[model samples]
Target: MTDKSEYKDSFRCGYVAVLGRPNVGKSTLMNHILGQKVSITSRKPQTTRHRVLGIYTDDDAQILFVDTPGIHRKEARSINRYMNRAASSSMADVDVLLFVVDGTQWTDDDELVLEKLSHAKGKKVLFVNKVDKLADKEEVLPHIAHITEQCDFDAVFPGSALRGHNLDELTKTLKQWLPEGDLFYPEDYITDRSERFMAAELIREKLMRSLGEEIPYSSTVEIEQFKFNDKGILTISGLILVERSGQKAIIIGKGGQRLKQIGRDARIEMEELFDSKVFLELWVKVKDGWADDERALKSLGYDDYR
Candidate 1:
């Protein structure tokens, strides 16, 4: 797959940044494009905190998809500021920008995305996602029409990432705009993120789903230990950080039932993701105001990976 002969003389390759407000299916779109889950998704906003690259290669084209944290106007905490910076930085030095939005609803945040796009000088493409949830199918065209008035985008695509709708058409359009260049990664590689990073994300995904509203925004997961034992079974020790003892009690639940369930579910996902047996352990620790501290964020592995 690494052989240059596998590629054609006119092979196209370029970076495409997937930018939008939070919870607008940006991660879902990238997962569908790559045919695997490189970014975590949940009902909760701000699920993606760092930038991840999903690479797709074929006979004539290779698309390096940049899945960034969602952009918003509010930068209340250091983490929010970091997310905004990550999203904005992804827009620079890209062949094109795929600005995604929820077709079912519109808000000032959508306008905020447009404002960001207004300053970006590269080719812009719009994707109105989640059209399958609309009560009336006819609302899609009107929504696209309204957004077209705001910015003269090079192209507009309306599709549903959830249902795999119109994605083939979307891929065709993206391939046409790429520049002729060598592949940045080998054809067999789907993502640039390490296995440890993905393990932490998978654990966080389970916690977010299990704890639901009781979990505070300050909560984060860090893998303290990850190694294979003599028998070749993976062993993992994770630290679940919270802001207060009360949050810890809530996560622990009565007789530690809740934490056990969270660990059980997370271990199952880890085994599936790694394709090996895993022995997992979890502990809750209080880290007061870690989200607001920039140094703490860096220690928690929130910094950019390149």
Candidate 2:
């Protein structure tokens, strides 16, 4: 008598890029799909500064969803151009393109996004995210009609990524579109980013949440320490690099209130995500014109990571 183990054949696998205008909830959709925060999101446009790869897998398929930076009509700095390229880079050889749109409005930004998609040659799914916030789903029809008229997408789905509305349908639709192949990532894996990367993003999310409009844009968080303790604690130390001394003062606040607030918010989220007590340490450093500095951007994992 002999015991035998079961073996399965190749499963469905493919890459899908989640692209859209900023604040359209692309990152939120991605976080929902992966069941974790793989990307930082904010109400501000261009929140995502890089192409974040989040892997979702079940018994049948593994979908590598790339949450890219929001596209804007600008050629300002090298990073802006890099972010723009990050959006299109996912299209080169992906099985699907999840083109997300804000359900709140169908203004020129939506049209501009559609125009970008028109040039992409891939199977596309139109996702009108934030449907729960919409007073009338019918209001999205004109925008949908306008986009569908321009490009022949495979399907259109109205969903609330925040509220988890119609997400099962969206997942099911994606499952159907994936091609049969070996799983790109193991079933247990969720994202390709490392612990340090996630910590940096968490810090960035706090900056986006706590800081004023100009502050987040002028600062970048860099992780300098990441270590796990035997007592189930994770310690992360990072520096907030700002573009100016004035920005540093703003981040530190009048009596270090703002910095403390950001640290508290970030540490709380980090603890939850890591499932351990997180000791987050952040410092502010002024590096003038770091945003436009090629070396600085490269070190921050922008063009190099791309």
Highest-TM-score candidate = 1
In TM-score terms, candidate 2 sits at 0.92
TM-score per candidate, chains pooled: 0.96, 0.92
Overall local distance difference test of candidate 2:
0.82
Candidate 1 vs. true structure, TM-score: 0.96
Give, for candidate 2, the lowest lDDT window spanning 10 residues: 1-10
Candidate 2 residue runs with Cα over 4 Å from true position = 1-10, 229-232
Judge candidate 1 at residue 76 and give its lDDT: 89
**lDDT per residue, candidate 2, 58-131, as tens digits?**
76667899888887777587777778777867777888889998885766666667787888877899998887
Write candidate 1's Cα lDDT for 1-306 as tens digits.
Answer: 476667788899999999999989999999998898889888888888899999988898999999999898888899898888899899999999999999858888889989989888788999999888888989888888888898889999888998889888888889989998888899988888888898888888877877767464679999999999899899999999998999999899999999999899889988988899999999999999888899999999878834
